[model samples]
Target chain A: MTFSLARPSTIVEALRLLADDTEGPTAPLAGGTDLLLDLDDGRSTARRLVSLDKLPWKTLAWDGPRLNVGATLPLARLGSDATVRARLPGLSEGVDAVGSLALRHRATLGGNLGRAAPASDLLPILLAVDATVRLVGTAGRRELPVARFLRGSRQVDLAKDELIESVSIPEARLSTYVWQRVRPANDVSQVGVAVARSGSSASWRLALGGVLPVPTRIPEAEVHLTEERPRPEDVELAANAAATHARFVTDKRASEAYRRRLVATLVRRAVARAQIPPGER
Target chain B: MTSEVALTVNGAAPRRLAVPDSERLLDTLRWRLGLKGTKEGCRTGDCGACTVLVDGETTLSCLTLTHEVQDRAVTTVEGIAEDPEGRRVLAAFAAEDALQCGYCTPGFVVSLTGIRKELGASAPDSAVIEALQGNLCRCTGYLAIVRAVARIGNGNP
Candidate 1:
């Protein structure tokens, strides 16, 4: 029943608010789609929630090389932006599928990544697009690759006095890709496989939620697909390795065995769909 | 612990008050604003029964803090008909028999209005369905709801 709310109008002010508060569990609130749920359910340890909507941190801009998405940019804007939809179709599609339109309209890409949920729709795409997170703290701004930014499920590398400012996605023509998954009857994702292929480098970005602790990527599975048609046997081997790498767990929604089975099937389907020419659709 | 939370509610400025830090926007709307049209079916974001529009974006009022929405514009189902597009959406919902139990209707109406306003003529059927995935309607099926919005927006039966 006790919580401190801090609203800052500028990024520097927000950073200072985070840096100065050394007293309790702290979390930055963007849209509150995820963090508020955790708090209400007693799953979060946040006692001091720093509201970021007051700051000038919701702008979306392109600096000619990278797309600088403010930490507070809602998921709706990310998905609806024409430039994003055309340039990063995979990311746009992923954000579009995050929740109901209402949730997406309020959920922020930074908040989604900051939550680090294995089933987070945006994480795999971020990994596939080579996105980086910019964190501001007392020491100044530092950038970390999306892969390294997420520490684990529900955990991040953000210090007590730090906040993610924006995520910079390098401008890259997203080759054909597919993000297919199985969700519970309620549209909650069970297992997700995000695949992206460059001109010659076909990469499979695998991320599973509901049956694992956090979103995971299998480098071997991705690297193995760079060559000719991947045989089912090859995919099976890669799926097992990826599942093992993810430390697949048995959760109420899906068992580890079922998840493993899905890994193989989803990986194969994702790769096949990724090879489909963009204009064909 | 008292804070002055001010925002434009339904195109009108209401008397700002000092609310406790623990109050959420959903509770504030129901208890303070007395706008009972915004139902609180679930305190969590999983259910869209508590959906509202903040700064023209559909958001789960249950999850948003009242203080966080200060200086923003809030549009609830009650306030939706103030605009031409909103009137069309509401009329369509009524014409389609979209509500049975009616508890989730207001949220759906607000959400659909927001989507149609944003998508205009370019929004597809798949996009409409995806936009409404969060809203749960246990009654009247979804045909009427979908048909109402589609008919109003597209001018086709």
Candidate 2:
């Protein structure tokens, strides 16, 4: 219930503050949507909360076909971007799937990645799009694929003094995300499926969210969906494989059997939705 | 754990106060600033009862730390009707009778006002609906709320 806030105006100062905060556990505060809740519920013991407000990370830029999303950019700014919608529909879809407009106004993609919640609406889509996390620390700067960065539920590969700088997404792809949830507004998804095909290579990437432990990419399923224009039966095989690929568990959000079923159904639906016409591709 | 802070509330001049770092914006508004219009429903972020505007954007005050919004402008339901869009939203809600228990009305009003400002006057109905997805009405069946949204989306606001 008690904590000290340190808002550093520069990256160096921020890093030093985080590194020097030997007071209990320390947490880097982004939007505070998830972290504050954790702190309130005794889920976090972070006595020193470092705010990233003054850092120049609230950027969203396009380089050729790639997109670089600044870590502090609000989800609302990202979701409402016409370029993001036109180029990366699945990413936009996932952004829209989070809590609400008000929450999204304060929720940042970096916060979502930093928290790494088991059912984060952004993870599956980030994996499907081959997004890489960019981090900076006293040690220096480095990048990691989102898959490698995720360790487990509420766990990430972030170091104590390191801060997420931005997320680098490869070329935009033909992609979409679908999910099943009790309430469309504020509830967590029971199962989320992301389907994507690279615009240049035409290869496929399949990822599932709301799974046990952590969300993961289904390479076995992606291999089945190799063709740019897959046959109907191939899509079916990929969907079935995706359902079989994950290790589902019966949790408070959904039953194991129900989640697997949802993975299959939503994957199939998302694949169809993400499919591009031969002329367009 | 506490520090002196300054902020603008409802178009007022910047005021300074010392507040605890653990205090949420909702707590600061209701308990410190004596602005109880922003009700606390879930205390969690799930409910929209603590909705307020931070620098013209809708934010969940219950989840927002008071220090997080230091030096920013916060507009609660109490000050919403002063804006032109807020005036229209309030009028539409009144015309549509968009209240039952009225506990959620302030949040709904503040949030809708924020959405309208963000989306502009000609935002589509779907956008309006989607923007309000976080708000909940435990009183009425939401038919009246839907009507109020329709009225606002149609140029009545």
Candidate 3:
């Protein structure tokens, strides 16, 4: 509650502020939805906050095959942007499922991935889409796969002076996302699944979240489903394989057994949804 | 440390004040500026009672630091009273008896106003529902609120 805030106008200045030792450890603030809560609840002991609001990282650009989403791009845009909705419907669906409309207006992609919460809606979809994250620091820029960027719950593979710049997702085909929660809507997912395909059924990518300590891709299940275009029986087998790969723990929102079951069900549904023709969907 | 930050509120002239770095915009509006219309039901971002507009975008004031809004335009419920669309939405809410306890009304009104601005004249029923997801009404069961928004969007009194 008692922290000094530094609003740096440029990325370099922001990185400098984060590296400064005189003010104690500084946490980067992007769309303060989660950071402010942590600051309010005494969960964060950061004595200083480096605001990324002024940085010129609010753009969403498509260069050839890669779509670059700035870390600070608000989640609201993800739902409403025509280009994003057209090309990355799975990511759009995941972003839309986050909190509420007002919260979406303020929540940013960086904050969503930076917090690395187990139930984050974006992480599973990003993993399924094979997104790459870009980070900048005094050491210059580095890119890492989304799965590797996340270290653990409430942790990221970011250094004290580093800031996430953007995430790049390659173009893919026949992708969709689905989730199941205890609440009807506007609640964190008990189990979420995203499936993306590049060409054939064998090229399918699958990721699951909320049933594990981290959002993760299930290559074992994906390989099983890719052997053939998923039939009802194939879906059931793939779902069971996904459930086997998932590690769930009982939380206040759901039981371990229930979440594991949800993992199977949502995975099946997500893949089936992904296989539907665009015209029908 | 406290610093002087200047920003426009409700289309007013820019106002400057020395605010603490940790001060949230919700506190600044309610306590410092005496704009009590922006309610603070939950200090966390879970509730939409503290919703406001920063640079014409719906934002949760409880999570927005006062300093972060420096030199930007902020719109609270009090500032939008004269806006034609805002007035129409409020009138529709009144006609539908959309509220009971009324603590969450200001937030709903502000959020709906933002939705109207974003969607313009053709706001769909589903978009309105999505927009209202952030707001929670403990008293009215939300049916009246949805009906009010639908009526306003449909050009019906």
Candidate 4:
């Protein structure tokens, strides 16, 4: 089954095309890394594809205190950008771990978040950094926290007529991301953890992925670490607390017990790594 | 909904053809243009047998749509045969005996070409490994392929 593809040069035109249901179901195509695979597999029945490749949103900019990442900015740029590496080190690490170099050159941040895969490397990092997603439609523009934007596995809080405009991350310090994968290279993580600390070291955020229905943060663990500088015992207690909150399932990749164990270990390692001097890592 | 899209393949004159929007660049290259050098492996993006250069950057033709290549230059393995860097990559592959079945060689060669273009000079072993991670080799255990890329990176060929 082949579909007609429409290349919209502007966001308003794209939104209009998406909103016209009388023309049949229309799906937006970005990067086409995952969307093409779905089309080839007969998973998508849309009759029209709205291509976002030529839109003006494929850029990265700094707006005041926050970094504005255009929804169409390729993952390769996100991983290699100097400012992103310095300010959002965890996000850099997470984007670098996605797919391979070739795929990275073509994949976009919007596609990664739009797919909303539970094992997506970018989701946990975005959650840890407290990123916000900017969405636009005929209804005008609104922003949603990254955590709230993701509704469930393979689902996002996106209306059919709305398109993601950009993702903004506020600057922070001492951020670190770590993951343990079955393969050493070019593989998705079996378990992933991200940690970001403020200047005081007392305030920190934590998020985990691949072990829950959605990439999420454990409030109990975050509160435990926010009280003071984390000691080895505190790290251990936080790790266990995070493990208790994670609800893992047995899949071909790993067993439920193994994922639970990995959640604890990765959280500990990520926290420790965040404390290391930038020059050392 | 078929439309005429113009593209430059292998440095040839821009060719215009009518194609369906769902037609992948891989199919257009192989079926329409008869450029069979770009093999189809794991039609999904996992296997990089369909690797090509779009505007000098490594790209997977299988995942790329026909319209995306409009007015863009695409260099396949066939087109790079006479290129100096492409020749060095191919020569290294031969000297290092980097194949058994040879089904995945074109993709590796194209990927190496992109890596050489990016690095511009000798590459560390770690860099070479990272660049070829997308191209998979079911034969030769990838040792000879990695050596071939390293040889090219070291300027030995």
Compared with the true structure, what per-residue lDDT tens digits does model 4 show for residues A166-218?
99987665777898888856677888898887543356789888866889888
TM-score of each: 0.91, 0.97, 0.96, 0.95
Top DockQ hit: 2
Report lDDT (Cα) of residue A259, candidate 4.
92
Roughly what TM-score does model 1 have, to 2 decimal places?
Answer: 0.91
- The residue pairs found clashing in candidate 1 are A118-A215
**Which candidate's lDDT is highest?**
2
Compose the digit string of candidate 1's lDDT tens values, residues B1-157.
6688776799996558788765788888899889999989877777788889888778889888888878889999889999677788788887788888899999998887787777775778767766777888867468888788678757653
Winner of 1 and 3 under lDDT: 3
Predict model 3's lDDT versus the native: 0.85
Candidate 2: Cα lDDT at B78: 91
Q: Candidate 4, A268: how far from true, in Å?
A: 1.1
Segments in model 1 whose C-alpha atoms lie over 4 Å from true places: A21-23, A175-186, A198-211, A228-245, A277-281, B154-157
lDDT of 3 by residue, B22-53 (tens): 89999999999999999999877877999998
Name the 10 consecutive residues with the lowest summed lDDT in model 2 chain A. A272-281
lDDT of 1 by residue, A129-232 (tens): 66799988877889998888888778899886788889998654442333334542235566777665434345444444443567666786665655445677
Question: In terms of docking quality, how is candidate 4 classified?
Answer: medium
Give a tens-digit lDDT track for model 3, residues A128-245.
8889999999999999999899887777899988999999987664778898877755688888899887542356789988856788888878876764367778788879999888
**Candidate 3 C-alpha error for residue A139, in Å:** 0.9
What's model 4's TM-score? 0.95
